[model samples]
Structure formats: C-alpha cells, structure tokens
Target: MPALPRPAAGPGSRYTARASTTRPRPARHTDVAALSRHLTTRDLWLARMLHEHRVLTTHQVASLAYTSLRSAQRRLRTLHQHAVLDSFRPLTQTGSAPEHYTLGPAGAAVLAAHAGCDLADLGWRPSHTGRIAYSPSLGHDLGVNELLARLAARSRTTPEAGLPVWLSERSCARRWGDIVRPDAYAHWRDGDQTLPFFLEYDTGSQPLSRVEAKLAGYAAFTTATSTRPALLVHTRTASRDQALRRRLAAPARELSLNIATSSADFTTSSPWGPWWSPLGPGDTRRTTLTSLAARWTPLGSAADLEPTDADTALTLPVPPLPPTPDAGT
Candidate 1:
C-alpha cells in the first residue's frame, strides 16, 4: 500500500500541542462512585467553581475557600493526586508561577452527576485542561478570577458583605452575547444594600476607543431587557483607568449608562471600599460599590437576575460562595 500522507497539520497538530505544560493525568482509575466515598462537600463545590470559572490559581482557590494557604495547598494536592482536579504551573520570567487548576475528568463526572445530567451536558472535554494551560487569555482569566475571589473571600470576615451571584464569562455570554458580553456579572450585597453590575476587566491591551465602544452594547442591553445594571471598567493601571474614564465619559452620558472606572492600585486594599470613580463631569470622588446603588436608586427596580425560559437548563447560575460547612465535616 502507498504510504499514507502524514496527518495534515493545523490547529491540533503536534507543534501546537507542545505548548501546554500540564501535569500528566493520573494512571489510576477515578469514578464518581469511588469519589463519593471520600469527597467532601467543599471539594464538590471547588469542582463546580473550577468548572464555571475555567481556571483558578492556588492562591485564588485559597482565598476563596480555605482558611490559609497551607491548608489550601494540602487539600489541593490531595485532589490533584486523586485526579479530581488537574493543575499546571506556567513558566514565569522571574519567580515561579502558582499552580493553576482546572476541572479534571472525574470532576466533570461528579459535577454532571450532581446536576443530574450527562457528561455532554457539562460541556467539558478531555482537552479542557491543556487548552486552558496554553490559552493566550490565561492571564486575563486569572485577573478576573482574582478580583472576584477577593470579593468572595471578603465575605469570610465581613458577615454583612457577600457575593450571592457570580457568573463567569461563558455564562454571561450565553445570557447576553447577542447584546453585550461582559467579563462577568455579579450581585454584591453589603448589609441592606445590593448592587448588580457587569464587570469589564481591562488589561490595557486594547485601544481605549475599543473599550469605550462597549458601552453601546450595554446601552442596547439595557433597552432590550429593560434592566439597568451598573457597568464597572477595572483597568490594570491608574493611567489606563483615567484614559478610559475620559474616553468613556461622553459616550456613557450620551447613552445614560451607569458606568464606573477603577484601577488595580486602588482596588488592592479592598475592592468593596471607595475605589470606584463614576463617569461624569466633576465626579472625581471615589465611592464604594454599595454606595453606587444609592447613587443610582433606579437599580432597585433593575434586579432581573433570575434565569429566563430561554436559558439552557444546564447553564443555570451558581452561588458565588460555596455552601456553608456543617458543624462538622
């Protein structure tokens, strides 16, 4: 027989596959029944979080779930050993990079079983971890997760503050891709105040004009859905923050979009603090996220977060924070 032509090289060629550095999958078998024997409620929740967010770092997972980094690392390593979670450490220019985690095959099985659905319903593939490990948007995804994880972590100490609903980019896109695709959508509750906002985690990679243009979609989404959630544009640097504020001010006002801008520097202390600067002439003072609800009283009538009939049953929203642990686990 004539020699078969070498497999055509394209997107899935060996050359492209070499980019990922994820640890090898465990050779040992992992099944849902076996997992049930030892997996705790927190482990299941972490699997759901990894499934929803795509990826999270060791530090981010620690902030969101564990009491300390040591505990988080220990449990995470256990999960990794059992193949409930897969991890990869990326090469860094200086110090080492934290191990970034994604849902493994066993995790997807557990999630699907818990949700009363098939593996296909989970929308995960064998290539999921490798894809995320080598994705170009890995840094951006981590940044978004870091900010939200901080908000979730804050609830641990501040009993009055909580993030009830946090939807990842995929979830947001499913709901509003036709109108506007926000980086994430969340409901921030502080005492008696609740603010629902769409986040735009800017990394200073795109032109300011392109960033400003996103307001048009938000404006349309508001009109189409008759809901007016706040739009928060968080930039990597203060200079980018100011530039975005200036560039977006006119259009935001023109569209009557409730928009705000903040930088990483200001948010390092506490994102829930007075770090957000609204767009408008002479509106220079930063304000808290809860206060923004007061600033735009109309948000009271804009609480339309409930899933609609059009949403796929598989894509229902998940609580940002895991369920509170029982008295003893």
Candidate 2:
C-alpha cells in the first residue's frame, strides 16, 4: 500500500482536470433516454455499482465485471463516451494512475428512472465526479472497493464461493449510522457457509487509540439491534495489524464482539485465504474469511439486512457479479 500522491497545488495541476483529453466526455445535454437503449444489462448494473461505491479504478472494475483488462477498458471507454460513467486519473509521481470512475449524469438519470424517483432524490449533481476525484478519502474508498473486487473475482472461478451482497459505506450509514459507521457491509459465501461482517478499512493514518474506541460503538450497535456481525479491521501493515489486535483484544472480548484483524501484506494474493486472525485468548493462528464462522459458532445470522420502507429495488444492493451471459464481456 504505497502512499497516494498528494494533489499538486495551483489551478493548472493535473488534479484539476476531471477527464483526460485523450477520451473526451459527452456533452452535458446528452439524452439519457437515448443512451439507455444502448446500455446492456451489465452496463446498467455497472452504473448502479458506480452510484453505490462512489468510485472504482479500471483494474478494480475489470476484476469485478470483465474477463480481461482489454475488454473492460473497451466497454468502460464507451460508457464514458455516452456519459453513463465519468472518470479521472490522479497525479502520480511515477507512472500514470488508473482511470477512476463514478456515476455520470446520464447514469443517475437512468438509475432514478429505474427506481421511479426524481433525479434530485438520487442526490447526484454535475459536480459529483469532480468532488470524488479530489476527496481526501479517495484512497480509502478505492482500497475498500479493491478488497471486495478481489473476493468477487475469486467467486467467478470457485463455484462454491460468492460475494452475494456488498453494501457501500453510504448504504451502511443509511442503515446503521446512528449506531456504528462501518466502512462497508458484506456477506461472504463459501458453499453453505455465509459470513456477514462489517469492514473497517484502516489506512494506518489515525491513532491506535481512536481506532480502538470504535469497538464501543460496535458493542452498542450489537446490543441495540440484537445482531452480532463480525468486525474486521484491515490495516496497511503487519505492524499495524499487530498493534490493533493487541489493543482491541480485551475490549472486543468484554463486549462479546467477534472481531478479526488483517493487513494488506497477507491479503494481496488472496483476501479470502487464511489472512484473518481472530482477536481472543488461544489459537492465534489465522483463518480464511469463510472459515471464520466456524471459529465463532455462536455468531448468529446478520440482522437489519431486510429492506426497510426507505428502500427501492434500484437502491438495494446488487450481486457483486453481473448476470452470467454478460460476464465474459
């Protein structure tokens, strides 16, 4: 996890430009209805994904949706052309950064129409792409997406495994913000075993104490809602992971919160593999994400997963993988 490059100062810096000149964006007046005709089911799904996740890099998009990088690039470029998606490349010290994408105006329109809601209700504006492009939390957002994308990709080849449900931070906030603000919420399935957990993507920027304090909120959330989902804290380094496990162990146990900690070093190859270590007394050995459920047999089913009065079909979490017919594209 290399440090993200800081945005250069001045009006003319690369950070100021939202899109590259090589692939120009469509006009602001692009008709959403006409563009909708050309969008495949997969394209519509991608638009929904971008709307939910805030942002994803080209590589991450490929991992989640396409069979190859070349094919992903091709379709993504076309989406950009139709203003179904918007993109930006960050200023990097060495090589160029991969194109990062967000929902475009047409995309929002399509999504709103699908949900049978007004465009304003979707909470999107012309400045959405630019705002996310320059957001301070951009790296954290991308890291979260990257980890989930890897798990989703693994499910493509492994028949027994799948990431059936993935809720972005915004969705998590909507459902449980009053209790605990998790980075994301997901349901990881390996055969008959399903592990529902809330993710905390730590960049190792905040103080360890502040991070430890988050456990109290999770405890309150569990007590208030009568749901005990596992808390997974993923840090940037092995050292940071060790520090977190040490700090969170006692508090997590006292609160009866099933917590686990993992770092980027061990998860790079296979995030679903044996990288997660449970925070408790004995057998500090790491375990796979799916196998984690067995370690904590008392861990019950996830609560608050059902749709509330506020949810519409369009706003609900979509399956991480696209429909089988269009996945290869």
Worst 10 residues of 2 by lDDT: 1-10
Candidate 2: lDDT over CA atoms? 0.81
RMSD of each: 9.2, 6.9
Kindly list the per-residue Cα lDDT of model 2 for residues 131-159, writing each as its tens digit.
99889999999899999888888887897
In candidate 2, which residue pairs get closer than 3 Å at backbone N, Cα or C atoms, i.e. clash? none
Q: CA lDDT of each candidate?
A: 0.78, 0.81
Question: Which residue runs of candidate 1 sit more than 4 Å off their true CA positions?
Answer: 1-26, 300-304, 307-314, 326-329
lDDT of 1 by residue, 1-329 (tens): 11111223321212222212433444764667867667776887888888889999888888877777866776676566566887888899997788788998888888888778898878899889989988999989988988888887888899899788899999888777888888999888898888889999999999987897788999888888888889989999999898888889889889998888899999976899899998875465899998887787687323345767765545777666667652222
Q: List runs of model 2 lying over 4 Å from the truth.
A: 1-19, 26-28, 327-329
lDDT of 2 at 35: 64
